[model samples]
Target: MYKLICIDLDGTLLDTRQRVSTKNREAIRKALDQGIEVAIVSGRPNCFTIRIMNQISGRMGHITFNGAYYRIANKTRQFPIPKEAVMKVAKLAQKYHVRTYFKNKNLSLCTKSDPGILDYDQFKSQTPLKDQMDMLYNVDVVDVLSNQDINILKIFAWDENLENVRKMREELKEIEGINLYLYDENFEMSSEDTSKGKAIQNVCADLGIQLDEVVCIGDNYNDLSMFEVAGLSVAMENAPRKIKEMVDKVTLTNDESGVAYAIENFVLKENE
Candidate 1:
């Protein structure tokens, strides 16, 4: 019997509109009611992850910042990049002229090409006005290197040019204290010891659950670590071919409520 379910947010649980479908939400609620623990594992910052979870249930667990931070209600765990490494990354990002977002457990900050245009504000506008206000209070545009109390747990950098992304990622790989994850035109950095797999192990340990009793569902390369550690791994139909090939099962697409389908057919059905 599975004791925990780790779901990815962007392309697994949330649809194209970035909202969890009614079916997905209902499935999650039913799973919770059935005594199954569900946790969101994503590369997003804590505030955004917490906001999304609040939409489904006020009480939920999350492994946020790509696993630099883990929290479930009052319990929490953090793996922060060393201050020296964070400064090195900030300097490198500035040198590369790539837009970057840096986040810790409580606050998030971003770099802007023009002081007049706040990239974070534009991103925040996608949420409700009330939530924007709440997020805004914790988000800021800043000269990242100068922030004495930055305490950054994760760094996300992007540029339109793939070459720039590739070169920067190569340099970042040389850094001793951080783990680098490269996507198409963006890259992420966190503590070397942090990953969704390790975060889930930590959460399971805290809750007296075992790794073999966990199930994970996701649709991207970042979710690979979770797959490696989970007892049952599921990929969305919309996921890349390699991702689908890696998982034990491939469910419907995010638009079709794939998470709900997987839980209903694989989890709930088996439990019944």
Candidate 2:
């Protein structure tokens, strides 16, 4: 029997509307009742993930920044990118005119003013939690160099033009000491060799649970690592065809309560 489930947020748990469905919440609660641990592992930061956790009733582990940082109960650990690497990426992002968002231990920051970039407040309001969420309020409009002394957790770089974003990713690949999660029009940068697979391994070791006792579900390239470590890996139906092909099983789409479906069929039924 699986002792734990690691879930991805964006395209697996949350639907296209970016809200957790009632069915998914009920399914998670059911798993908790069965003494199974559920975790929210995502490429998003703590502030955003925490709010989503609040919506679901029960204890849940958090693995964020694609696994660079994690908090289980009161114990927390962070693996920050090297300062020099952060500076290099920041400079390159500026040169490429790519919109960049930075996250430190405490909060997030937005620098590199560009006409193409949306107004901070407007951008914040558009996210899932809207104004209720503390979207980018930490060090608003600060210079990247001024915050060099701070420990940087994650960096998100993107561009309106897909070509520009793709090109930026290519140049970013040449830089050492960093890991990149490539997407269609954006990518996430973190300390070298960071991945959800490693983070889940650590969490399992802490909980005395073996990797074979965990089940992971996600819909993106970032989730691939978790799939590698998990005993049973599931991909959402809405996930890209390539992603689905890699997983052990494919569940319904997020709009169809894919998370709940996976839990009910794969997790709950198997336990029964």
Candidate 3:
């Protein structure tokens, strides 16, 4: 029987509008009522991750910075990338004028581009206003990263040119001991060993659960790691063909409350 559920926030649980649908909210509650432990794992920083987790109730866990950090409620842990790897990306970002941001368990740092404007319009589009305010308060100056003394977990770069983003990714791939993930809007770099998969493994060990007793659901390439580890991997209908192909089942799209459908059907109903 599946005892744990790992869900990705941006694409799997949050709809295109970037808000959790009521259907999904109710379904998640049902799973918790059924004694299923729900965990939110994402490439997002802890600030955002914690906000999302707050919205859910009961038997929860979280993995942030793409698995560089793990949190099970009040407890938290960090899995840091090598200092050399982080420094290499920082220097490269500075040299190339790439918009870069660094994340640690306590603070998040970002390069200063427009002193007058820090929040990019596109990146801030769907973010909730309060969360944006929280970020503005917590984001520190980029100079802190130059020292490399801080426990850097992940670095992300953004570009308007999609092709350039992919190109940079190809280049970053040559960097030893680092992992790079390219999304539609940005590139995330981290330790080669840190990923949602590794985080899930760590969480399972903590909870005394086995890999086959877990279910995972996500909607992007980043979510592929947890997909690799889950016993019942679920891909949203909106997910790409490749993601669907890798999972055991395909549910409705996020806007269609795919998470809700998966839990109520495959989880709650099946277990019943």
Candidate 4:
């Protein structure tokens, strides 16, 4: 009876190596033919999400930037973070000497830190960051920082210290209207209302379906909120113990076509 399906990309839908399995693709096509709405919700940007969608045969919308932007069909809608919140986060990041990345309506900005901080060639292959000044460029990049006019969505800090990352998350919790999460060793900050769960709700409203008429599958901490709202929640076999406990069922590992298994065994069978 599920009318909508929300899927997470990196750890739930895509295999460990980050490719959608043939079995999963076929299963998804089968679901679409049956009138179920499927959406790819992820922390990645639209540029990267589009590449993944191209591999599938059908068209689907995407909830990206951890829910800061929603892309459907050919149009995208952006939700702006309050200017005061952005300024507060920026000041905190600077005080901690943490390198930060900013995303506006049309651009992503970051500092040129130690080459060791990132796999330059790999990053360049995925995103177009050339010709952009590093955050550490000559003058204080802080001067260029204006939360007022920019539709700041989320800000991320890349650091290798797990302890510091934890501390940063705790500190961000003090921010009045923002939500913070720790991914690996990075810290992600977004508006209190912007999350995968909220994005899914928005999509369901558009389709005139109830929240309980949806299924969500994912394998990370950020996905917990979505699982809470889904009627049928699934976790990948490779998911962390905490994530596995939050869902009603655990499917095959992503490496073993888990997404396809769930779709074929549950969603499609229901239609038949």
Which residue pairs come into collision in candidate 4? 111-135
**For model 2, how does the per-residue alpha-carbon lDDT over 1-272 read when each residue is reduced to its tens digit?**
88999999999999999999999999999998998989999977766677788789638778988888888755678889887777777776666667777776454555444453423334343334422323352233335455557788888876676776777888888888888778788888899857899999888888889998899999988899999999999999989999999999999999999999999999999888
lDDT measured at residue 107 in model 3 versus the true structure, 0 to 100? 49
Stretches off by above 4 angstroms in model 4 are: 73-76, 114-141, 160-171
Residues 180-202 of candidate 3 have per-residue lDDT tens digits of: 77677787888888999998988
**Model 4 C-alpha lDDT per residue in residues 54-161, reported as the tens digit of each score:** 678446677888888886644566676777777777666666666667664344555325444422233334443521222232213354566235567877777555
Number of clashing pairs per prediction, in order: 0, 0, 0, 1
Could you tell which candidate, 2 or 4, scores higher by lDDT? 2
Candidate 1, backbone clash total: 0
Model 4's C-alpha root-mean-square deviation from the true structure amounts to 3.8
TM-score per candidate, chains pooled: 0.85, 0.83, 0.83, 0.84
Reference-based TM-score, model 3? 0.83
lDDT against the true structure, per candidate, is 0.80, 0.80, 0.76, 0.73
Better of 3 and 4 by TM-score: 4
The CA-based lDDT of model 4 is what?
0.73
Model 4 worst lDDT window (10 residues): 130-139
Of models 3 and 4, which has the larger lDDT? 3
Candidate 1 residue-wise lDDT, 1-272, digit = tens: 88789999999999999989999999999999998988899987755776778788866688988888887745788999888888777677666666676766645566544243323444454454433422122233345346566577888777666776677677787788989877777878899989999998888888988888898999998899999999899999999999999989999999999999999998998788
